[model samples]
Target: MIDTERQDWARGWSKLKGFVEREGHARVPYEHKEGAFPLGQWVAEQRRAYGAGQMNGRRAARLEKLGMAWSAADARFQENLAAARVYYQEHWTLCAPRSAGALDKPVGQWLSNLRRPGALDGHPEWEAALEAIDEDWNPSWPAEWQRHYAVVREILAEESILAYVEPGVTVHGMDIGKWLARQRQSEVWAALADGQRERLEAVGVVPHVQALEEPAGAEEPAEPSTAPVSAFDRGVAAPGAVQGPARAL
Candidate 1:
């Protein structure tokens, strides 16, 4: 009976997978370039739509409403990226996965090196990547081939199944773009309310939890805006309640 149930479950999963793939693939934009990361592609489309005036009032309104949530998510990503840099700086040794044996020129090493100050700033690859940036801030990468470059290379080393490599040992560039996008998306998600959280989660959005916190500043938050008004009323305004703006107009 258990075997039968298991088989049925398997069949159901297969059917579900088929349905999702069909629907998802169909919705995919045909304009997808040969070598574009998924997030990069999405970002490009967003930029194009925004630039070409295709986003329209409705889209702008929605984005503005969502902007605060998005900003929070962005802050989180910045924090994560900062944490990752700290981790790499302290534990550069574990940057490469165990599978990368005998290859003295592993991708992890290259990526770690790139993390060093100014290492990638002048690199030909970096320059090429930057040059391909469209007015919408989309960079053109080879669509068919995956890159196992730098940080992506490290991710590949850590999880082979999580990444794909191509001719130049490039980790799937799409994954890299997606990683960056998630970091950005987290910024949006952080400021959202419960309903927004549910919506994002329904779409499989997951943010990277910050493993550490930065030191807190000694400065306190500014006093509330109404403070001065209240103080002035008590100290001087009560005697001449009708003053300033009231007297002016």
Candidate 2:
């Protein structure tokens, strides 16, 4: 009976070592099997034993050497966080919708779920890890809106004249010109939050508020009228020389 138990443990450890070498982590899926060996089940049993305080110190230390993660959920979070980091490096933003993915992970949907109210409760470390990649991994405004802002910022970094960016123009697959047109609308400009407006202004994207000429003998200032002015007519000077119309309060 003692010899049989030692052989069983040796077989399971061999299979687990091979699994770790191939996958680079000891996070085998629950139903995974290595040929005829139930490696996944064996790994789960060890975790159960560890939880029950029945696992031996030497055995647990050996498992840890192979990068074993006792808490499966913590292992999953680390994997997803790695994917998020990869996505951020490529796109410079984490405002991906449900359809986005990274490193074979459903990172977009994961981030979307995490952005829900109180979703990170008791998970401050997870929040910190994400913020380290991009501070606005979650924003007060819509994530999609933040995505647009990030892409446009990239375009501006190239010294592109955004005002002249016509409709249908795209940056990073986003229709920034169409988006800018919407932001220039009086109603849309009025609807934007103060912080959003300020960010736009800092980037020389203030709305083109052309003022109508004062009537004959009028004492009051010219009434401001917003128009779909051509880019040339929008006072789109080179960066430091940008002079935009006064925005409505």
Candidate 3:
């Protein structure tokens, strides 16, 4: 069942967002709040933050300033947040159609998508980093994982997330999720001719390699140990094992 809350929020956002474009404005309801953001203030703030010259630091500072200015009255912020959430969702749909149901995928399924043939065949280093990304960032996605995966793969393989142009890095507007998704897929790696594959693998996405090499003192990967355990064997007279719940006390 679709979550009613999300449905309502999305519907409300669609209505409100119509007034958020370059030449759009929605008047605040008098009863809603007297201190709501005025159109002019909102535009100026957006201009400062979204302008070509703004960096993350400056953009964040501006946002914090705006947040502080609106701190005294939170209704406006809440409204904007709700609207923003919907806006982000819509943008994802357009830019990353594969993430249609990203909020609902099972973690395992999403992880497994990383292993599909030709998906992450190339860029082994990037693939490993993505597979090893902090669990906190692992999406607790749902069945729509495919859609998000498609979006991510596209961005990583084509658009890239780095905003600055450099010899070994691609700069684009794609987000982490999309970029990671690309790492899982075999875009660059899969497309290589056999002769080029080994060379690419040895090179292995220069940016990712540099990142992994940053910890100069990190230990080399240890040889894996092999251990065996059996549920039945462990259940029988194992030291400190429970003895039938202490024989029912």
Best by TM-score: 2
Q: Tens-digit lDDT track for model 3 on 193-245?
A: 45334322332232222223335575877454475633323332265443222
Superposed model 3: Cα runs more than 4 Å off: 1-105, 131-242, 245-249
On lDDT, who's better, 1 or 2?
Answer: 2
TM-scores, each model vs. reference: 0.17, 0.62, 0.17
Query: Which run of 10 residues does model 1 get worst, by summed lDDT?
Result: 134-143
Error of 3 at 27 (Å): 40
C-alpha lDDT of all candidate models, in order: 0.35, 0.76, 0.36
| Per-residue C-alpha lDDT of model 2 across residues 1-249, encoded as one tens digit per residue | 479976987898889999999978786654468999888778878887788898889999998898887985654676688788788878879998788898799999999999999988987877887888888888888888888888766766675456546566676678777787788788999999887888777666767666565689988776565756544344354463334432211
Off by over 4 Å in 2: 1-56, 59-69, 217-249
Per the 3 Å backbone cut-off, how many clashing residue pairs does candidate 1 have?
17
Write candidate 1's Cα lDDT for 37-151 as tens digits.
3322343344455656765666555434422112232332223333333433433322333233222234334434434567545445343332232111111222111121234
